[model samples]
Target: MTLKDFLKPDKQANLEVFSVSPRLIPVNKSINFNLYINSSAREGVDRFVCIWKAGKAIQENDVSEIAKKFGHIYIAENQRNHFFKDLGDNKNLATKEKVEILKNAALDHLDQLFHNTDDMIQSESIKKCLVECEAAAIGLMESIRNYDLFGLHDLIAELDFHDHYTLDHSINTGLYNMMLFREINPNATNEQLKIAGLSGMFHDIGKIKLPNSIINATQDLEPEEYIKIKQHPIWGRDLLQQEGIKFQRNHLNIIKNVVYEHHENYDGSGYPNGLKAEEINIFARMTSISDFFDAITTKRSYHTPLEPLDALGVIENTCGIKVDPYLFERFKRKILKDEKLDSALYLPKDFDPCCPHTALDLMYEDEIQKSELNENDQEDVIHYHWAKKTQLPKIS
Candidate 1:
């Protein structure tokens, strides 16, 4: 299935709840998490039967045997924390494995949030979601914190353009914002990264509430249209709050303020409130820098995408106008420091749905099509799936 199809809430009435990458599961060891392959079902529904139970020894060949027929895996949504925690505790996990796990999890979580936050509000699923979000976000932060300013350069490799722009952009913005937070504060705590990462993620959530027909009716927006666009921050802020639900007040305040004020520009020239200079929140200011960078680099309907270096120059011109000048400087140096690591690593989503994409699919199209079962070649196909099913390694 397409990532969009995999993420759709309308499809959730079936057995599958969440997806995971096979790369996230360890080889030659009994995993703490369960893994599933789909059971044949009614055409439109997915009923998953666990193929690998938790604590069972998983031989490398056993995973391949399951993967040969059903190319993907599923995990329960509630097991997200356990999955991440296991990844963190596995001292032997490779850097590449960690990168794949983080990239896939980020995209999945952000996509679900974008699509289901509305349902969360209507049904009061907000509290449960927030707890899950915090655990997932913090786990990601802890796993990558030792990498310094480079959160995950291989994750940058998947920053290639795609139709699923909103969700992809949000994931990039959160990772970039988290890295920038560390650059600004070298000893940033997991709590600090959680606020920085999630605020950047939901910063533009307000835009989703507006109708696309109204948003794209003209080349130049009407004054009313402008106001509607500007109000996303307010909607985003309000969306995080639920009546009678006890949230961590301070943490919620930082997250809400960033979403509410990220659109407010640096000098005296932003929207909604137009409060100038230091009046704009710091986390919001940091997000503006990351948000602007990702927006310009990625393909958008109104404009062509720019190269990262070229995008940096474009961001340079808007230093004081669109984003904070000081924070932009920090973000720039961080990008340059890690530039060589991702020199030619970007792969489009369609080609590499599972992240930590090593481009094996493009190189081995023929071999993959006609290859016979061989123990030596089994590990090769694990990077990208040929068919679809729920198998995010049973979110544990």
Candidate 2:
């Protein structure tokens, strides 16, 4: 189903909002709602609880004990003293406070992860990072509902993965994917936005399992190595299941489809599952286009990335074979308007091509000569330059 269809509020849908504590429940039973200690204001509902296929309310015997476990009322103002500045007048109190609280919580969580040891991945930090990411995903959707596209875009810049470019790439893709969603449907509700954001952020998390050498490799991968690389989606899917994050069919399906088919081709030439055309999950199709576009446009080891417009050309050339034609058409005209596309293609005047960190590590004469050619004497900068057609190397 399209995003709009998925988010249509079911007033008739019987979802119970318990006035008591929500605790761990088996996945086979009632859906456990994990209340955010901070920021929960939807129609004055501070706690979000969802279970697949709503069932009867809990018995009175369980209510009193649940209430005892979650004693005392939690207020947003109380949560803010530890996080932000003044409340700034009380207008739109619920929505505004929710934004502040969730954003701060997300930031705080990310900060803890960032400061953790290099072995942070092995610790609970990665899972906490994912939790924070989930919260930010929800908060971001609410932000989109109440703000402009540009304001939402700025919030994305704040969610930077400065520690690892790969992590940054995942979050940015999720953010951009949500941005595109907003652009397509200005009236998109919070839940749909949340799912899209979460799916986007965790799309390539399987790469965490691959060897750092393969992930950080600057050269072309060998055939066997490439095969090993392709196994990440399954690895990631299994890893996520092992973590015991209760995900419904829709959420799990979207996540799995994105992880597995984001590399698939519309012309039936893609990997893992070679289903083509309308057979591809709509969400996966959308993400695949975004993933490929961003991968080619963003800087990577094997190649100096193309500008966005050049990337657009590549998309145009590959559509029907590499991308869904209809989706590409909308993406080009609706999302990347001609003027904005031109602006996106513009490189900063002082942009550098060579990564000094990588260049400085070179030990060979040829490597030093190559680095010297890329270096700017006046600015001491190593700028990336476009190579001529004859200089292009073929992938083996």
**Candidate 2 regions with alpha-carbon error over 4 angstroms:** 1-130, 142-161, 300-303, 336-396
- lDDT on C-alpha atoms for all candidate structures: 0.60, 0.49
**Candidate 1 per-residue C-alpha lDDT over 261-355 given as tens digits, one digit per residue, 9 for 90 to 100:** 87776655666688665688889888887776676555556555556665565455445555666666665666576453212222221221111
Top TM-score prediction, candidate number = 1
Predicted structure with the largest lDDT when compared to the true one = 1
lDDT of 2 by residue, 167-210 (tens): 55566567656766666555766566666776777677666666
lDDT of 1 at 161: 39
Error of 2 at 180 (Å): 1.7
lDDT of 1: 0.60
lDDT (Cα, 0-100) at 20 in candidate 2: 19
Q: Which regions of candidate 1 deviate over 4 angstroms?
A: 1-23, 27-79, 88-120, 139-154, 157-164, 214-218, 244-246, 334-396
lDDT at residue 171 of model 2 (Cα atoms): 60
